[model samples]
Target: MGSLLDNSLQIISNTTGKSLFVRLWPLSTAPKGIVYIVHELGGHCLLYDVIAARFLEAGYTVASHDQYGHGLSSGTRLHTSNYQTYVADTLQCLEEVKCQYQDTDNVLLFGHGVGGLLAALLAAQNPGFVKGLILHGPIFKFLEEHASTVNVCWYLSYVLPLAYSPVNGTDPALLITDKDQRMKYARDPFIWHEGPRLSTIHAVTTAMGDLEQVEEPLSCPTLIQCGQDDQLLNKTNLTAWSKRCSKTTKLLFYEGAKHYLHMDTPECTIKVLDEMVKFCDVVRSEAASDTDDAVGSEAASDTDDAVGSEAASDTDDAVGSEAGSDTADD
Candidate 1:
């Protein structure tokens, strides 16, 4: 186990002037990298405690923030004016974390549910900046039931954007197979029980559409994890989205897992964490290799330049000596 340093909380304002609740878990020793956790919809940063602890033990500094309209952040619960607001808020939070921990430039993004979508967008927008992406049950396309309501929600947003309807929420049982875990999730005060507002639904759908139109493939390493038993998403969609990314994209499905793989049963949760740690290690190794390759290429280029210059100088001297000898013979 790695030694823990003092954990701290910070409040940063988003573009809309809402204060985002930021949490930093720094390691006592030099960290291998940084993992910025992005929570699912209706969930807060605290929901990532288990995963964050594991990352901390694995020598990573965990940085997270309660997004606008979630947890301790200032906004309407489970509501956002636009999907871009979430992206903007997350980008700002990441920048602040990067600024604070300038020593550790290597960073990975761990996002869950809709947060996964946000992370993917950020990684795509800023190519090569993020080393890797770990998406836990990312919601690329809504379940059949939710997709069916898209048209209705878009129409209703103008009239009833603030309406709290049952369709906007999910069954807790579908989220976790373990009864205890499901109960705990339902009971968590920080997690909003109320469904997302109609306006929020519109925002999410718009964002999903935009994601499909992203022409450039995500260049960084991406891990797309899904549960075989997840009722909220379809494996086909995840697979299709992975194809849009670079060859480094990995799609893994847990046999008996559900939506919240990180918070699933002990056996399943352990497997998820272990896989995540392994992925991070692999990404770190690849990054180191790339750096070494770059340095080697630069050195080779310099050596070639030096050798070419020396040969040119020698040839010039030989010609000058021959010319002087010829003149002396004359």
Candidate 2:
């Protein structure tokens, strides 16, 4: 039972018969709000300890559950039936946390990588469930770079749904620009590196397609941040999301960071974290407003004009400097 100074770790089980190891960082008084942390492919709830502590120190209660197939949870390691499975698990964990904490309706969902995809789709699918959505290096284009390989994998899913196969090997360095961070990831005993199963590839493709098809404005305020030097995803994905999402979407490309911007050193990581905290503050104010529509409209316009403009004009510079600095080490 690992615990924080003001937190406790607990186990939660859902209907799927999976027991997720969930942790909490609680506030002494009523929390400002709740933030649910959803991690990426190789990540678990515990791996987000830093962010959870940071949010706790900032007056928000934080809770996170290890995905069914990952971390301390029981399942076929690093596998899931489809995207909905992950979403269901995440939603269940949130409810359990809320119940445990006696929290109110105000909620913020934070996701990274594939977890980002799950969070965005969940908020999109369930309107008003979350007041804020934060996606760091969201997976928009999953394995499209290897379309031929993915097609073969998708076809194989019909016969070998449970069989595991490898995606192209990813460099650990791509996750963070810091040498010590990369080394820590390499040594992390809990990391899952077997890559995606066929079903997951198929689910990823389908979910991304579904996200692209939704033309309606996002129901909740969203902030999407991707490192410009990210090796896991590209700027094309950024452009697609900027265009695909509502005016409420705030987008940013960190100048010299990599895919795991949250894990990057303070110079780069703090900037993105600061932006996220600011965006959440804006949404919390909106939630407190007497008129929802007016605030939403103004916020959407400001996001569109500010983020959309910066995304276009600054990405090139961010990309341009990638060659000279240690950024390319990712």
Candidate 3:
């Protein structure tokens, strides 16, 4: 079993005119593919070390970058009023990984909560870059059935972009039924308690609107897994999102789980990872088969050319020998 430190690798993205924080966990055998993991809201990449390790163990090179204004990244903490900056930063990070790991057999994106929303947006925009998607508790609709509150926030953010307000009446403990996990998250220093900025909320709302209007079918394979008891999203929204997706989508609903399924029920999460890796393995095998066929065809053509040359030489020698024999006989 690899330790947490063993899987840690520093990554930086200079595409956005600034260096951003990223971490990678390379599989022991260098992995069959690469996966870009995006953390949930108010969480850092390091908090996902344990989860990343599961992917590493399953022979995947897992990498995650902290969004600007969060974690170890060099930016204004708790200051991103607009969430588009976060999405743009994530795109830069993905580009860096694609460049650095050019030989990766496959590329998959895994995201949670707001990160999942960003992942969906990226997948919607750049459909060809990612081979597949794994979304856990994606924020398709914010505040669940409480549309009134969401509308109020949306209006406020549009009018006052700089407004800040603490999310009221949310019990952190209710996020997960697992007491141990809840306590750990509560005490984790990387977990932020501050509410989102007005701009961030606006960005989220805008993203949701865009997501709702996504009518074009995605060609890539997708997996949408959510906890049955997640408070942030409802089953109706999840079902609607999955139905709108192309037929190449898989949905998993975990009973009695919470938003942070990876932390609350790791075994189930690992099972899902295994399924994703299996899908990637099949894709890689097909690609390898195609390459081998191309090489084989070229080799066969070369062999045929060589054989034809040898046959021509033999014919020439036979004709010369017959002529010489005829001359001798004459």
Candidate 4:
């Protein structure tokens, strides 16, 4: 148990003026590449440590940072006072990791729930930065439309800004089937059960709006996994969204699984990870081949130019040597 607990660590780091907490799990062997795992709304990085450990076991470095206004991150908990700031903060984290891991060219972005939404936006913004994407039950839009009454309440809270209101219509039991897991989640010191800020709801809505208009074709390979019984986004929308992607995208739906498919079906999740690793390997091989072809073309061009120059020089030398020999013989 002591050795098991030693594998995880809670790291507090500063990013964009906020104290952001992250969970880092390094593999025993050198990592193939770094994976940036993003958590759901109101969820901390530690919640996904088990998932990260699986990746670590597969010889990949896993890192997850709590989003602003959530977990150990220093900001308004449950409030979306500045949604764009959250996006920008995520971008900063990516840049920081990219700088830190200069040797590792393969970077995979994994996001679950709302984190999946942000991951998609980030990938859409910078196509070349992410090698592949793993979206687990992404919250593209709310299951039910916000009624006018809720909107009015949200507006009032926005005016008040600090006023707290209970988020309605969320089934706590749906998150996890295990009673111990539910109890642990509720009693966790870093977890926040309070309703999200009015500003956050507005920000999510706005982000959804932007996601709808994202016409830029993503170049990275993507895998989107959703539970068939997901109470969040239904299957129809998930199918539609998957079709919008231009790159190689595979969507898998597990029957009888809920929103938290990772916890529900760990074996399936691991299988998906293996598939991703294989896909990345193929991409790397193709990229290396392309580079080799370009180098070979340049080398052949250089060799042809050198042969022409050598031939011309040989002709001149032959003429000079023959003249000298003839004059000497005369």
Candidate 4 wrongly placed segments (more than 4 Å): 1-15, 145-154, 164-170, 177-180, 265-330
lDDT of 1 by residue, 113-152 (tens): 8899889888888887899999999887787756667778
Clashes of each: 0, 0, 2, 2
Q: What TM-score would every model get versus the actual structure?
A: 0.95, 0.82, 0.79, 0.81
Q: Give the residue spans of candidate 1 off by over 4 A.
A: 1-7
Instruction: Give Cα distance to truth, residue 267, candidate 1, Å.
Output: 0.5
- Clash list (residue pairs), candidate 4: 78-197, 80-200
For residues 59-123, write the lDDT of model 2, one tens digit per residue: 78888888888888878777665778888888877877777556467799998988888888888
Better of 1 and 2 by TM-score: 1
Model 2 local distance difference test score:
0.78
| Model 3's TM-score against the true structure | 0.79
Q: How big is the positional error of residue 213 in model 2, measured in Å on the Cα after superposition?
A: 2.6
TM-score of 1: 0.95
Worst 10 residues of 1 by lDDT: 1-10
lDDT scores of the candidates, listed in order: 0.85, 0.78, 0.73, 0.72
